[model samples]
Target chain A: MGELLRPEEWTALRLSLLVATTATAASLVPGIAVAYLLARGRFWGKALLDTLVHLPLILPPVVTGYLLLIWLGRRGPVGSFLADQFGIVLSFRWTGAALACAIMGFPLLVRAIRLSIEAVDGKLEEAAGTLGASRAWVFAAVTLPLILPGIIAGMILSFAKAMGEFGATITFVSNIPGETQTLPSAIYTFTQVPGGEAGAMRLTIVSVLVSMAALVASELLARGIARRLAA
Target chain B: MKEGLTVDLDHRQGSFRLQAAFDAPPGVTALFGRSGSGKTTLANIVAGLVRPDRGRVSVGGTLLIDTNSGVALPRHRRRIGYVFQEARLFPHLSVRQNLLFGRWFAPRAEAGAEFGSILDLLGLGQLLARRPAGLSGGEKQRVAIGRALLAKPRLLLMDEPLASLDEARKAEILPFLERLRDDTRVPIVYVSHSLPEVVRLADTVVVLDEGRVTAAGAAGEILSRLDLFALSGPREAGAVLAARVLRHDPAFGLTTLGTPAGEIHVPQTTVAVGSTLRVQVHARDVMVSLTRPDRVSALNILAGTVAEIGNTLAGESSLTVRLDCSGAPLLARLTRKSVAELGLSVGMPIFAVVKSVAFETSHRPPAVREG
Candidate 1:
């Protein structure tokens, strides 16, 4: 398997895994908070915020990538401020690929978690309150545990989406061969050049296998949480 | 200790308005009302779960809510335990964990209550490791009660804790509640619409009708009022009496209670001598006899004068007979025909005969007895 793929193909595979894992892990906390807010909060401008979170799913990936590039690219307003203030550069870096994937996968993550949070019985939270638990403790002990299955599902969905991401990764980070080339981008690169069919096929099979593995892991995690909660 | 709970509340949910006030001093204060009568809403106000638009609530001396001073404490901070209609035990935690969940938040200074004793009191020793899903309705309520007590709350609010149970299950839980009321110092505000439950459990009755406090006083006096039955509804109308186990007759297997009315013989109680029992006599179960009939099997007979008479919308008849014995008020419901046959009128002397089986002895201990 190692001999079948070139060094650059292997590097892209390794980089893609790193980027997707980083993206999923980094966005988990904020994803849960946003999901909870959407599911439970009643406030002005909530619909607008929800629509904004869902924009990436409906807008063309290239358009989202362009927006990211303009807003988060170095020398752009937010990008220049971040670069100067925090020495962070998200243009043409592997981190840029992670940022693109996180933004693109966020809607799916929030949606799964939001549905689970909404499904939780509010009466249970009130009971927790009466049991002397503050609102924060109630969320930590009751709401979080009850919605854990959804969180796992959301993380897996985001990871799978990140692994297959192509348009946003390429448009935002320019698909550098060894730096920012994710699996789909690498496969796209292999298909574009002459006599690259074998590499493209190999990367495509790897993508399918990775997605299947994530789906199975998600199911197992969900089942384990359900059993623990039931017991 | 001067144990008391006072709540004067006024609130509105959309178009529905709730304006109620009642004072319950210790014991089991039963908030009696029909469904949607704001019984639960009032309990929630005490628990600090629902903030009243205007009024003050204090349990034992701690002010939980005082809208005038803008001192409305949050539910957790108030240290008032609430048992919901459905036992909302945390699904993720084991039974023991759910019971101790509140302990983690209770102030360390107030955490002297022993968990072992609480579990023993509620008969929940064997259920420590099991999750709530594995428990029966009765067991769940016991665990809920234990959880609330372990929090060392100054007040406990139970909103129809047995409303979800069947008859057998309710019977299963009532004994534990009796034990809790007897053993614990925690003041409880019990909410229910079941007449038997109010009779068996409550020492103070706060009757609410359509979000207003219709009657509130000693359970014996307030529940026996015929006016409350007309105002609150028929199903929840009954009288509660404080009685002591006078003697246990082995031959008839009956326990004679020394109540205000007379020596009432009830089905044998397992309680010891000198222990007080709360007995509920439903208005419908009481009969008015013009004279003490001979060859009667009924053991409880008290001579009383007719206090009041009223009828429900369904044409069902009810009569409140205030007995001269011990100055206690006893309610006897007679048919409209019986009312005429006995020629019962206010100040007319009559015999109120209650069957031995009709008196339900609620076994709550005297320590938590509300005046």
Candidate 2:
């Protein structure tokens, strides 16, 4: 496998792994919180919150990427605030690509988790309440364990989405070799140049392998959780 | 009213209205009613799962809810344990973990029973390592009960915990419940629609109809009320008597129970002598005769005056007759033809004959205590 790939292909493979892991990990807590809120909370503007969380899935990937660039660019309000306060910059960086992937993957993660949360029995929470468990404890002791499979499924889906992300990463962070360049961006770069087909094929094979591995891992993780819960 | 659970509440949702006021004594107080009678709703209100628009709820002496003062204790802070109809055990946790789930929240000082003893009492020793999904219906309910009991709740509310089980399953859990009732001092508010369950388990029965509490009193008094049958179905019409186990006749496989009405004999029971038990004789099983019949196969006979007579209830052809048997109330159900043939009416002298096999001896120890 090592003898078949050039250094640049290897770099893109490593960068894609890093970006997908970071995106999946970074969106986990917020994804779960938003999913729970959407599934159980009855506050005002619930529908609006739901719509916003799901917007990335409905909108075209380029549109989502462009929107992120406009809001998170160095001169944008949020970008300017972060750069001035923390001396941090995201534009044209690997972190910016990861950010773009995370944003694009958020909807799938939240949807999977939200559906599972909704499927949970509310009576168990009530029973826990009567048994002296506070709402937080009830969620931790009962709700969390019951929804573990969903959370794992969501994370894997988001990771795969992040791995395959092209339009969003290119539009938000632009293709830059060894910096903002990811697997998809590098593959696209290879396709545009003369005599780059071999490199693109090698990188594409790596992408397919990584995605399959993720899918297998997800299947095992979900089955393990179900077995533990059923035990 | 001095102690126990007192709930007087009014709640309205859409078109349904629940306005119930009842003072339930400790021990086991059953919320008895047919389906949609609001008994479960009342139990939920007491458990703090449902907040009433107007009312106050107090268990023992603790003020759980007072809408008048805008004071309401949250469900967890109220220290109330609720065993739902479906058990609702944590499927992801082992039975032991489920049992210990509530102990994490209750203060150490409030943890009353030893965990081992609770497991023993509920017969859950062999199931400690198992999960909820693997448990039978009866086992799940027992685990649910153990989970609640381990919580050290100030009050235990059971909302027809056995309603989902078949008869065999229900019978399997009843003995454990009886042990819990007799051994623990925790006040239990049992919600059930089955009359036999109410009679066997509840020391005090609160009858609900529609959304109103139609009757509330000692189980014996309420079960013997002839008029209440109009709401509690005529077939369920019966009398509960506090009886003392006299002795067991091993040779005949029978046990003798002494009640205020008279000495009654039943099939052999394991209950020790001198232990008090509640005996339920269904009204339909009681035969009424104008004159004392000689050479009758029935073993028990009580002479009493017909205190009241009601017309056929719930379209049943049988007329319910309330009798005062030496200060004890007894209900007798007779067909309209038999009532007319005997020319029976209020204040008429009647002999209520009961077969020994017809009575159900509720083995629950009469450990009546205030909540």
Candidate 3:
């Protein structure tokens, strides 16, 4: 394992882990909120909101990256406002790569979480309300604990998707050596060069193992939560 | 006048419109109605789970909802506990934890009831460590009741708490509820469509028909009124009586109860002497006689004044007679031919003869309370 992973490959693998972890953690709260709204909220424009959330999954990765560039670029409205007010920048930096990865993985995360939230019984929430819990307390106590498995699954899915993201990250943030080149981008670079097959294969194996571990962990977590909630 | 509950509500969902009004005192007030008659909806409005389109609800002088003033407290702040038809216990929590969920959310100043006593009262001590999934239907409802009681609610709303249980499970939970009503000072607003359940539990009956309040009075008087039953449906018509156990005959294995009019003998009850028992007498179970026949096997024979006479339906031979036995009201269904032959009319005296075997004991004494 040590010999197959060249210095650049090792750096790519570490960077991929850091970027994926950061993206997944940052998107978790909003992902859950959006997913719950899609699953349960009853409003006039609910269907429209649902379609908008799923737009990323249907569009080509490069197209989504270009849209992100226009919207979150340095001179874009949100980007300039955030940069000026909070000194936060997300253009052509490692943070920009993380943002691209998060956007790319968001649809999958929300889909999984929304399905789980839909499965939770709304009657239980009403029961909680009648038991003297405020709406916020009911959500925190009953709804959150009941849908924990979905939240964990959503996180793992986002992490896996972020780890493998390539087209969007390269287009939006550019493939910088120690900054934005994630595992998939680094593997693409290695395959394009001569005598880089062995390194590419090693990184490929690493990606497969990481994804498999995440799936198994999610299965176990979902099962544990299911057993706890089995009535 | 003692402060009680007064509700006048109007709500519309889609095309369904519900408008109802009633008043109940400090006792077990039953909101009795059939399915789709807005019973659960009314209960939800009382618990603050549903906001009525227009209404005014006040319990013991505390305004809960007033559309005119735009004052509506949320469910949690209403301090009214609700027990749903299905026991909605927290599946992830143990029985003990589920019971404590409401207590954790309740303000510390309002938690006056002792936890140990509640456990003992519900007979849930042995199941404390078990998860909700491991419990039987009866046990789940008991835990639900304990959870609501621990929250220190001023008024409890039970929406057919026994509706999901089988006969045996219903039997298991009925006694616990009786104990809850008798022991706690908190008034209960129980919602049920079952006549037997309302007869056994309620002190005041609020009969609803198609989202309208049809009858509201003491349980015995309301249950005996055949007109209310005819308006609501005959399947739910029955009479409820309040009686005290007079004596237990060891030799014959019979217990005699002293009701308002006379003594009633039945198979020996497990309850001791002097305990009040609510007995339900189905209108169909009664037979009338103008003269007292000798050597009859029927155990309950009481003289009563004919209160009212009403025909069942067109071309039906039977008539429903409302009888006033001393102060208690009883109902007897007799043939119209017999009623005419006997010259029965309002204020005429007659005998209501009931067979002892037909009287089914509605509830056992609360398991935790011994007379």
Candidate 1 on A36-105: residue-level lDDT in tens?
9999899999999999999999999999999989999986899999999999999999999999999999
Clashes of each: 0, 1, 0
TM-score of decoy 3: 0.94
- Evaluated against the true chain A, what TM-score does chain A of model 3 have? 0.93
Q: Supply the global lDDT for candidate 1.
A: 0.84
Q: What are the models' TM-scores? A: 0.93, 0.96, 0.94
Residue pairs clashing, model 3: none
Query: Which residue runs of candidate 3 sit more than 4 Å off their true CA positions?
Result: A1-4, A42-51, A70-89, B231-237, B363-371
True contacts kept of 3: 0.72
> Residues B245-338, candidate 1, lDDT per residue (tens digit)?
8888889888889988878888887889888877877766787788876689887888777766664345445444444445777776666677
Candidate 3 lDDT by residue in tens digits, B184-298: 8888999998888888889999988888888899998888887777544654456778889999997987889888868998778888899888787777888888887669999
Candidate 1 TM-score to native = 0.93
Model 2, C-alpha of B280: deviation from truth (Å): 1.1
Model 1 DockQ class:
medium
Measured against the true chain A, the candidates' chain A TM-scores are: 0.97, 0.97, 0.93
Note the residue pairs that clash in candidate 2.
B26-B371
